[model samples]
Target: MYIVRFLRCLVLLLVGLATVTHARAADEDLERVAITRALTDYIDGSAHARPEQLRRAFHPDARLLLSRPGTAYWPVSVDEYVGWFSGAKAGQPTGRIGNVLSIDVEADTATVKAEILVPSQGARFIDLFLLRKLDAQWKIVAKTATREPSRRSADRVLFVLSSAKFHGASRLPAGVSFGEVVEAWDAFRAAGLTVDFVSPEGNAAPINVTEAGEFRSRFYDADLMYALEHTHAPSQIDPARYRAVYFVGGSNAIYGVPENSRLQDIARHVYERNGGVVSAVCHGTAGLVNLKLSDGSYLIGGKRVSGYPEEFERQDAAYFKEFPFLIRKTVESRGGTFLTSARDQGYVVVDGRLVTGQNYLSAKQVAQAVVAILRKPADQQPKQAAEKG
Candidate 1:
């Protein structure tokens, strides 16, 4: 009886040892994938100027600690830091350089070091990240960075504001949303990207007074408004001179932009011939509704796209009933698959050289997507457009 009992105890001890060994091996595998995912998220986010990607890479409480010339450590929450990229500067190239230099992992914590270079500004940055595993997901919990800034050549972006006024059916006074244009303009300027304004008729586009935010309201000065009104005509500019064409949105854009043949020509030449990006937000996508390549096929055919949804238009059905067509339905019918986020939240879709923002809220992200594409080497652009024809 004693021999039988001893044998049973030995068997139990062996099983317990094997279970612990297997658990440790499983944990090690999970940690490997988790570390790789976290690092990939950081690289792709930084390269593409995508805050949505950055948001996923970071923990909710992550903080960025920076050292500026005369300041002690300046700490910014991940939420606050991501806000910068969602602005006009959002698409501006960060000129990220280098791969993950190294990664060190111990238990549930890990660290990564990466480098970025802004050749245009002659700046270099080294970023260090501290991440933790929580609930089997790895997320960046802290970051520190050092930058050496220099000078470089600047690229230009054309801001194409809609020149129309009033919603189609009700003829209610409407123009470009104040927040859309001003916010995008501020972002572009901050990113050091040169900007110029254009319109269908080369005249100042009107403003939708009701759409202005506090920052835009305070910054709306006569000089700025006057400049917006005196925009350059499509015929007057060389597409080769610009890196991207951004279509700003307003209710009137749906009516005025789509029918402009010259604007279409400019967008085509820039995107097809010069390897530039074409972008639009909100009602501005109306401009793309009828855009075609040199081959006469629709530009957006087979593309993944997003814009203000058809549901939003129906919400104002009484007012929009007179429009020629809704933006979402039009794009979808033309072979573009439409994507939407929570109504009115910021969302931008990038498919090769084409970028579209869902609404006014998505304007900055659309611009950022454009900037990210432009920052890539010319050869890196998806040859989809070239092959589509």
Candidate 2:
């Protein structure tokens, strides 16, 4: 009887501990959100010349410490900073862009690092801010900034994956192609690009890796594995932060990805709104079939696209039977010209901002194509007409 009582007490203790842990985690997340909002207000306010937002983000007594070429120290008050935008129209662009680089919070205090770009003047500045939680709201208490030559854009690429682990209703296992992921990842990273993973269900994506080698082993590291294990949901993604969206291919790609409306919206925002690239490899092209632009026209319309065509699949196989639609057929039906090369050969089609690969063999090439486009001079890059959706 005593043992039974002890076990019950242990279970209750564990449950209580778990509840406490979850509560603390929730509190931390809320704090982070509040802190981020404060930082965004500061960035957007400066870029748009909004005095009100700047006032909201900073404490009245906040001071900015800066330096001039001849002066050793320059101290500006919050009122002085807000007054600089006194006559400017709110929400008007000031030819300045800012991005939050990092944030660290401890107890009621926080620190933030942000990058501000004045492209018109070819200047970049790193701003460090100290913040405090006051009256349950985060406010900037102090700031320091330094200028440097403009460098690369802080934009990153988002890799979309499937959460489906099984082929349709059958028990046949399906997962993302580890080879395709590794190849494209290698190419992008080599070009100094950051990649983030997202899925429809926001869970760890299953992977299928048939062969392994030293090249593959180098990429299959703890950081990459952790990222794969904790992919963000579509709702959690900020399309403005991504310069491109690459749909990864596998048998699992044909299941949940193409039909997800949120994912499609994210891709559309990245392509049309941000003038970014949309790419796919092998079955990943399946996700592009349903992507439509702001004018209600299909994005792939009249463009050449390549993917894992139906001809290559064994039509009689159980996995093929579970496929909702064939890639080539859907592409054609959506007004896209489906193209391919000989079986197993690397093939890539670059039609403006859309880049598609025929198979896993072409994954690296597809990434290189995107990198080439992105690396182009601002004046030479393709311009996408912005439209409301």
Candidate 3:
């Protein structure tokens, strides 16, 4: 009986300790939330706050930084920044222009990083701070930042499709084939990437069932017929804002994308202005043959590239003659470096910011490569890291 009573007491004590520990955890979480809110409030307050208010976001020893592509790094002490802001406040005219990225905490030391979107000035930045407990208050200690003028996800990425009929250049003689629009849709959607499809004449892009079923089966396949019936221009796509332009080709793309001046313009702008990824497979790459950048340089000039290899022309013997020129010759003539795999094989090329898949077998490879580029935050992927040997 005495032993049983002792065990009961021990159980009660353990339960009480557990309760205390949980309560303390809850309190710390609440504190972290409070800190995040305070920092957000501090930054958003920069929208219109005087120099003194912005200082709250930074510690006395903090520094403000700015970087340019080829110039030396510039760093300013907190006092210098505040003093400069006082003089420039009139011209700078602050507004709501910032984002909270991540807040990581370990014991008493914590790290918070932020991204702020600014215009006129470079808002493309990632700022990291070290926080330490001083008198039970968390204050930022060390700081670093980076900036890129034209960066981030495409202001938009749009997809163009053609009717499924005569897909794979079947209407033409052998060896010439193109991408399938339905597979393109499925690949993009599976990766959580946003996609929009439109037709050349503004009609619904068709889906070829036999070809689509070959890859994705019913579950992964898109209802190309149904999508065409309801397709709309993507609101997320703005030529100036897009960081990448993707062309989804089908055998029908040979007849469609080649003359899409609108898509061509979007592709050229996104590439030149943003250094974005412009990708097409099979016949879709044909659309790029005529595009010229601001310098009047062919967009693909001197860059490694890939598309449906001419070998596929054998696949449909008669189709090869219809194309104005072979895909390989057109790209190579413009001084663009061209790449391919053995006939009907998967080939993907990564040249600077551009990624291209050789043919239908290479769609997912192209999609993953583009995402790798998109998901790479500028700060983490320092410009130097991308430099090839």
Candidate 4:
């Protein structure tokens, strides 16, 4: 009788152990599914602040990997990543990003692998995301990437667009003036910098809303308007977080950007403390004339800069009536040396804290100049090269 009872007790203990083991396996499987779902939602549903989905699946450090395929990688920050989420929610998706081929998750981290084939150029690209979990939550924390087409430089830049309206002319598509600013932006995006847009105020700084009916009647880029209307906020822009600030010009810039003291402060911080390029053109140049530097002197005081020339302003005789004076004269009087084109090319200048360009014609050259300066290694560009080359 004693032996039989002991055997029964042993059988029960074994059964209990098996049950616990099976349950553990099930939990891990569920966690994996949760991870995949969250990442998908982040990729898909993030537009509307799908907080519940984001909270459950991504750890606070969640990030996205965007880059050229097969190149050494760098990823954007969380806030920057989320800006896309908002934009995505507000607009139709442009496959600027390639397909997300896979998501690999481990005990505390994960990685996302993606491949891109762009329309502007048939460039092949690959990117990877590395994520980690804290407090039982998984989040994307890092990104590593590569691109098939080799670049002139290994570094990438993040260009900030402050425009709320697109630059499409009547005969052109919206944001047509994308020019070099947009082109560099596209290049950097293809190379995998999470370039994004945020307005001076949290709202979409109205486009040429009140301007020429023929010129201003249309909406901005549907894609960009989606991004702006969604993530448009001043708080998201922290100058300390970026390497440089690229301000593009729009006629609306005359009225939209000048009044923001905080935006001016961010511009100053990016220049003085972080040492990033602050490039502006046309009406976009107005922001600089008022930015006060650390030494209490205005930033353009002694810098050689350029923007819409006074003559060019006169050329647009009917359009520039609101501006009090010509950029060249105003800057020169303020102790800044102004630059201009030979009337054919876009004119630009780089002097210490300021980088300025002439009219719309000079936009591309100006962007290239800004990128060249920032790409240098720790201010070591053979002084002569920087000054004369």
Candidate 5:
């Protein structure tokens, strides 16, 4: 009677162990399927800009937390976050590509790490998702995000636009080149530099709307368009706030840029302190002609530079006759060793902190040069080629 009772008890214990093992395996399989579904929904919603997909993927109470450099936390609710895709055009690369890096599960809670790239806006984001099992379903409850720098992480650039709409002498409608500004703006943005627009007059700068080429037109999104219309004036800018300052070129630049005392002081402050790079392209070099350092020496004197060639001026006799001064001649007279390449081709010269581009075609190259200079340590920075006497 005792042996029979013991055997019965052992049989019951083995049955209970098997039941527990099966239940645990089933739970793990369910978790895997639910996690994958949530991730798929997120990718489709973001890449396609479909609010419905996003709505399904995220919990009603989910919040997106963004960490900005040296700034306070910015939180966005699900509805507010979906609003960003309201204007997205179908099939356009909105820079919303996402890749799952890893996913971890712990009982009722899970965490996922993902990378999102927004090429249009020149941004890459690292996102962390927190999820919980509610009503036997997994939904993203919160997300924390940080941006990964695409280039030199800490660089900030200032793009100086000409506020003059027409040259007083030439009577031509000239302000800033739409192509020049947008090209360099996009390049600098892609390289992860924070760019601010400023002008000599602190008013809306004119752009040659018709001058936007294929590249410029492709990138002229709402944000770029808005920034051009709301540029700040020189008086409104603080020199110390930027790591580089680029003078955008146009015929009107000849009217107010070189002679503006305030602009000169700002450039001097940036260059003298060795705090940043100073650059100009095309006719914008006119601005550099009279810039004197704090030591009372001309900024471009004995420095290598380039700008709009004399040939371009000669190409149009009527236009040339009405100009204030030839760009190349002014630069040379200022003791700058002017350099050039084939006309209309991009030619950029980097002389330490001073950079110059030959024409509108070179605008992008000049901006890139500024970024390169800012990336290096002060002690390891390349020295300017031997200056001319």
Candidate 6:
């Protein structure tokens, strides 16, 4: 009887510990959200010349520290900083764009790093901020910034992911390849390019991670996960702001994405109208099979495309049976010349503005190719196969 009572007590204690752990995790998530909100307010407020938002983001006593040509130190109060933008009309273009690069939080204190770009001036500024959670609100308490010459464009890249979490009408799990997403993301970021995520259904994109390694461990952070969980819907994206659109692949890539008309339009706009690259890897190539240009010609028509062909799939597998269409066959039927390399080999085809990769191994290469093209002068960019009418 003593042993039974002791076991019961132990179980209760374990459950209580688990409950406490969960509560702490929940609190951390809330804190992260609050911190992000505060940072966004600062970024948007300054960019859009909104004084109220700037006031809300920073504490009244906050100071902006700077350095001048001959001065060792320069300091400006929050009021003085806000007044600098007071004369500018709200919601008008200031030729300034800001993005939060990183955030670190400890207890009630946090540090944030952000980048501000002034395209017109060809300048970039790095802003480091100290924030504190006070009275249930996060506020920037101090800010220090440095400016440098920059030539990088303000354009971003959009990563297209599917919303499918399972094989059609079956219990077999399916999701976007986490490996492909991370590989391409790393390459783009390394090239000083910003990336955004979008999905057909607009919310959290389901992810499939088969193995753990350096890239996985490195990118599996709260920021990336949160972006994936809150991906923009097709309607929210402005294709003009992106230099490229890359479709990520996995079993989930076979569904929802290929036939989504809105996604198709966004890709078309990016490619035909905005003169941006349209790329895909592995099963992600399915997204390109149905994309049509403004002239009503298939985007991949007569183009050399690479993807995971049907010959590589286990035709007998349950997952393969659920595929709405075979990637290689569909591409061929759409007037594309389907190409591939040996199983698991990295292979990419750059046909004009269309870029496609054979497998996950080629994901980074595809992104690099897109970045190369984007880095070129406008006159040097590959001519579109079908220009918008």
Q: How many clashes (backbone N, Cα, C below 3 Å) per candidate? A: 7, 0, 23, 16, 2, 0
Assess every candidate by TM-score: 0.58, 0.66, 0.51, 0.53, 0.61, 0.76
Candidate 6: how large is its RMSD?
5.3
lDDT of each: 0.75, 0.85, 0.62, 0.56, 0.77, 0.86
Better of 2 and 4 by TM-score: 2
- lDDT tens string, model 2, 130-231? 999999899999999999876434558999999999999999999998878889987886675667899999857888754324346744475577577768
In model 5, state the lDDT of residue 214: 69
Q: Which digits, one per residue and each the tens of the lDDT, describe model 4 over residues 1-389? A: 99999999999989999999888756655665555555565554443454444444444565545553464344666666555545436544433333445554556666666555443454446756666666665665665556675232323233434543432222221221345344445544544344455556553434433332443322454434444343335565666765566666665455445557777787788888887777787667866777788889977786777776667654654445555455677778778777666665666677754567776666655666666666677665323212211
Off by over 4 Å in 1: 1-152, 221-223, 314-317, 382-389
List ranges where model 2 is wrong by over 4 Å: 1-20, 70-75, 87-92, 153-244, 248-255, 266-277, 292-303, 308-347, 358-364, 371-389
Best-fitting candidate, measured by TM-score?
6
What is candidate 3's lDDT per residue for 6-89, written digit by digit as tens?
A: 999999999999999998866766666656655665565565546766666566876556555675677778776556557656
lDDT score, candidate 4, position 52: 49
- Candidate 2 residue pairs in backbone clash: none
Query: Lowest-scoring 10 consecutive residues by lDDT in candidate 6?
Result: 380-389
**Model 4 C-alpha lDDT versus the unseen true structure:** 0.56
Q: At residue 359, what lDDT does model 4 achieve?
A: 62
**Deviation in Å, model 2, residue 381 alpha carbon:** 9.1
Colliding pairs, model 6: none
* Backbone-clash count (model 2): 0
Model 5 vs. true fold: TM: 0.61
After superposition, candidate 3 runs with Cα above 4 Å error:
1-156, 163-184, 219-225, 232-237, 379-389
- Candidate scoring better on lDDT of 2 and 4: 2
- Please report the TM-score between candidate 3 and the true structure: 0.51
